[model samples]
Target: MSGGADLPGAAHLVLADGVAHLDLETAVFNAMLEGWARQQATRFLSSDGTIQPRISLVRRFASFTNEYPWQWDSADVEEFINHLRARRPSFAVSTGRGYQNILRLFCEYVTDARYGWPRKCYEHFGEAPVQILHEWNTVTHSSDYEGSPGRRPLTYDEVQGLFDAADGRVEEIRKRRRKGALAAMRDSILLKSVYAYGLRRREAAGLDVADLRRNARMPDYGRFGALFVRYGKSSKGGPPKRRTVLTVPEFDWIVDALDQYVDEVRPLFQPGKHPALWITERRGRISLRRVDEAFETARKVAGIPEELDLHCLRHSYVTHLLEFDYPERFVQDQVGHEYASTTAIYSGVSDEYRNRLLHRSLKGRHSALWGHCFD
Candidate 1:
């Protein structure tokens, strides 16, 4: 074909040419995956995290079906989904939907006539691949928030206990002359910063010293007045979203904590010229796994429920901000949520806050009847 190399997915190229008899099917399947990877890369999907998992999922689906793309049908898709549901500790609804979406995307790529996969399959196997995942068969996104029910905002007391536990770890390490005191201190500040700024794990880990910015209005806080988050979650096939999370007055304690870490504690690690806000013992950037481990350790020490993860700190931030009487739009912007509805989902305001709100409403509307009661 003309301009074969110029095709979106390199669909004009033959992949299974000169393959051994027993390896032909495998070679063709591998080629299809490679082509898909190329296409996704062209669209700016991350190879390390996004494209690899997609290719792996396609391989898994193929393995389950025990058939090539041309032989895959609606029954295969349904059966595979049923198998997923039947497994011990079955996948979450959102996870199942995500799997189906990936499979559907792969099917769309292979069945498109312009991609030449369909024509190639027909020539090789006497049948073209058809899209197996359909609207009726696939999982529907029925819920706005499909995350784990166990993952809710921590109560105010719980947030305090968690932070105290993290601080205690630092103290314990220092008392025992443990090697990880610096790391413990970093972990303590990291967890606090996560909640203080309503940061996702990656966003916090991806932070550099330069990300700390000054707010013109909040000069007292100096460079800690705002966080320039460059690693906000990305949309499909897009760069990471960026936002500036302004330091709110309620969480202004973070300013001093961050200042001490940046000025005094971090220098002990000898992270010479490393721009990372959080550094490891080896003077490298702290990893995401380390962040999780830190939170898990503190959670256990604090006797918090096992279900509450690092992300719960983020939920707590949203909830606590709402409780502190911040506007919903302000909370939404702080957390980098695209919609106020998403901010609402993260918020689990305390019963005390709700009761106070109710009392205020009643006192405002029926001062004669409710004013004395509130007092």
Candidate 2:
């Protein structure tokens, strides 16, 4: 009502208080999304997986509060987060923190002056968007590792049971002349591969035949001597990191397993041109979901605890390698950790391992004190 000139957009009919019409409010919202899309794109994030989720979170927050970003305040964030916490199967600390961080990033993007979202909001709504969520109002980072306390590395017996269960499933299917015998066999090897190499689910799913490499020192093992992991976890805006994990002596039996699967069984999948190491029955590459499903099936058969997951295999790998007296830095590099501390956090070494370390220290101290040495 105060403006003299008629604007071209749908919200040209402005109120005396300078608040935007509904259509203009919608348009500003769309523009905010567009700006966020460009920002994420510039940083090389996937539109569907990364940017869209953030957009949906903002939309869900707005729906919860019945308030647009321009009207949101710290209290709204607090209430919505509280609601999340109160819901059944409440968000874990890590998950809650992730959602809080996503909201904070969106607020930062919208309020940044260079993006012009704040300026446009002010012109249309008589107020600009503000950074509503702050550290005081949201979850704070307390530790590098904040996963469930119940989640832990599988012990040696548990790992052995899991592998035996997987192998047993393959035999059972084959005995019954079932259609899934080959698939079951593949799953058996897949789960072992995940633990043998300390692979994340995605990394195992993304493997290709060519990713298997020969180590000159371990030529007897041939192509199964090392794994070239091209899908190691990425940084915030970076492509997946790459690493070559040499076959450790403890898990060397994996070489025979891989040789059998690759030479004899993989061709049965009829994956002609597909180079993926793990092929589905449909002759396509295995997905990350399938990797988890395989691990879960084996876990249940092995009677492992329900809380343990595919990731626990990786944890088991780290812990077991340490138990074997492998150098800490060697284990870190094998797992493709960016820092030694990150590798350290994954370690949940068994009590037996600690006891062995204590015994070794006592024996060494006795050797220093006495004339004779004990083996």
Candidate 3:
């Protein structure tokens, strides 16, 4: 293989069947993958995420067809998608559609004349790769909300129980003289902060000491005034978005919790000069997986429903803010949603709150009718 340095399996498989000539098919396939990777890297301007999963999808499709991209057609794609649908834990509609979309991009890239893959394939193998995915065969984005029905906002009682269980974990560990007491304390505060600020897991994990700022209006809360989120979700390969969330009166207890953690418990980790708000035992920033695991462990101990996950804390935040009669646009901005409709999807107000709203509407109507009758 002439370009064997970078390709995963290009070392010993260059000459085909003891032939004197280099294998054109193997060389072209590896080149196509390399070109696609470079294109993505240049487009995104950073390689933090989003390339590896796509490459894995290409490899899986190749394994399924046992043929290179040039040999694929619509029928092969249809059979491969059907096989995925028939698996025991079949892929969700959104998952199936994502797989198809990535494959479509690969085909588009390989068949484009500018990349030279089509010309090289034609010159060597007498054929070129063509797009196999069409609109009729792929999943459509039918609704704004496509999440599972089982997942919903946790009720106020459930949120309290979850927090209690997390705090209890710290005490339980400390009583036994165990080693993970500091880590548990960090997880407990981290979970509370997530709900307090209506934050995504990544946003919570990306926090630094400087990200916490003081609110002039709420000077009594001191340094735990607001959070400036630097890594809000992006769209269309854009840079991470940014938002600032102020501390509300309802979640003011978090001020004390955060102040204690920053002053006392965090020092135990010996994270000298590290800026991350949540420090792991290794003296580095905690990963997103640990944030999720901490939530799941607390939920199970509190006997909460299994469907509730870390995102549910954010959902609960939106729903409770709505219950407290906060404006819809305010809630949307707090959670960094680009659209109010996206924020609405996270809101699932309790029946009691709905009834109160209904009563208020009736009372206003009744008062207007009485005035009209008297006049």
For candidate 3, which ten residues in a row score worst on lDDT?
Answer: 7-16
The alpha-carbon lDDT assigned to residue 110 of candidate 3 equals: 76
Candidate 2 global lDDT: 0.86
Predicted model with the maximum TM-score: 1
Please rank every candidate by lDDT, starting with the best. 1, 2, 3
Instruction: Name the best candidate (by lDDT).
Output: 1
lDDT of 3 at 224: 86
TM-scores of the candidates are: 0.94, 0.91, 0.90
TM-score of 3: 0.90
Task: Report the error of model 3 at residue 217, Å.
Answer: 1.1
Q: Write the per-residue lDDT of candidate 3 for residues 288-347, one digit (tens) a residue.
A: 999999999899999998977899999999999999999999999999999888999999
- Candidate 1, residues 1-375: lDDT per residue as tens digits? 322345667555646345466676777788889888988989898888799999999999999999988899999988888898888463788888999999999999888777788777777889988988888998888889998788899888898999999999999999999798989999999999999999999999999999999999999999999999999999878999999999999999999999999999999999999999999999999999999999999999999999899999999999999999999998899899998898999999888999999988988889886577767
Candidate 2: TM-score? 0.91
Question: Candidate 1 deviates by what RMSD?
Answer: 2.2
How many residue pairs clash in all the candidates, one count each?
0, 0, 0
Write out the backbone clash pairs for model 3. none
